[model samples]
Target: MSIVDTSQKQRGRGVLEGAFQVLDALSRFPDGAGLSQLSRACELPKATTFRLLEQLVELGAVQRHGTEYSVGHLMARLGENWQPHPRLRRASRGPIRTLARLSTAAIAVTILDGDRVRVVGATRGTPGELPHVMADSASVSRTAAGQVLLASQPRRERPEAYTATEWRRLRSRLRQDDAVVVEYEDVLPGVCCVAAPAPLPDGQGVASVSALIIGSTVPSALPGLVLRAAGEISRGLAVH
Candidate 1:
């Protein structure tokens, strides 16, 4: 092969193998792998690993701090900036299914958009009757899912943050936990939901998984269950 062709082939190999090796390490070990560890784990020489790390950093796909390397904001964009796929559902299915089966409630994974919580992934429970995952609910601020997600807002977004009585109430709830609920006030007078924060790798409330159950069926101590379910989902999400 000519000199130019040989150089191109070498670059291509580096790009393909280097990117995969870095991603695989980050995925398998969320805490991130240091340069030395990556060198050994990827079985690439330290010199080559250092070169690829620099390239990926420039491309915003990998991050290096001190001597460690890990998935970066670019990886997050790749995961979140796609058309709907089975991965989101598949990634979250375990917790959603567990919550629904354990609580006998409709479980859903939601993404927070500009002013809405979208039902990007859903799973129906037996005789699923409640519907908090409806995309249209994005407009209704009085519902359970909406209220819980709304609680996650910074001080500027609270309903009562600017008001007289409601602001005080909202501040109180926000102080307690970024989770809130006002039963029967949301959609479907008989159904109620509660939410917990699912802050993404970045600070954005990228998504929330919720349990929507009939008010009558909800036990007196159900809020704990709801909160725990959200916590489980958050734990499953690998931190970058």
Candidate 2:
């Protein structure tokens, strides 16, 4: 399709068609595609293609190198989570609820969405109250769930979430295995969160299983529960 679908405007599609065209073209080249290449591939003017790419980059759906753009962290996660295979949301539902009940804490299954963590599955900590809403996304350098997923990534693949010094400090605290358990008490002032990694076959954490408890001190058993729950989910994903 041509890059900008002018007819889409009349149909009230907004700018989505232009954005999709850019992403569709970028997905064809694993190493990335230059501005001119993408423009030609999408059959759009260079300036129009550049504007679309800029917006996609801002949304974390596309990454820009020196002159080329490619599928970004968020898009890559979506591909795994929403396309051609079952995702953590399905495999983690039962395990997360069980953990929530056992720990009396909120449980969430999260994956990296750009520099932030995107919660895909959540079980309430209590009967009626919602856990702290993550809104668009949570900081990768701060939250327990975010940190676990960040730690799962290779040291060389630094997303813009953390600076060099910050990454260095955080990286030291990372566990070497996918079955990691980490606790953070100050993420939400009076709250504490503990997270564990659910590893994929590639040895990277496909998602994090986390428990949010309302207290300064985390329950000693909660960490073990989180780890086991994450492991259960990981095992399920492996065979699928």
The candidate scoring highest on TM-score is 2
Cα deviation at 211, candidate 1, in Å, is: 1.8
Q: For residues 1-240, what per-residue lDDT tens digits would candidate 2 score against the true structure? A: 454565656554646888888889987788999999999999989998999899899999999999989999899887764521236667887898899889899888877654444567778432211233432233434677767777567654554656778667666656545355555564577788888888766664467788888878888888889989988998878766
lDDT of 1 at 180: 39
User: Best lDDT goes to which candidate?
Assistant: 2
Candidate 1 residue-wise lDDT, 91-116, digit = tens = 56677777777778777666656554
lDDT of each: 0.63, 0.73
Weakest lDDT window of 10 consecutive positions for candidate 2: 126-135
lDDT (Cα, 0-100) at 168 in candidate 1: 56
* TM-score on alpha carbons, each prediction: 0.50, 0.56
Error of 1 at 155 (Å): 6.0
Residue 238 Cα positional deviation in candidate 2, in Å, after optimal superposition: 1.3
Supply the TM-score for candidate 1: 0.50
- Report clashes for each candidate as comma-separated counts: 2, 0
- Candidate 2 displacement at residue 106 in angstroms: 0.5
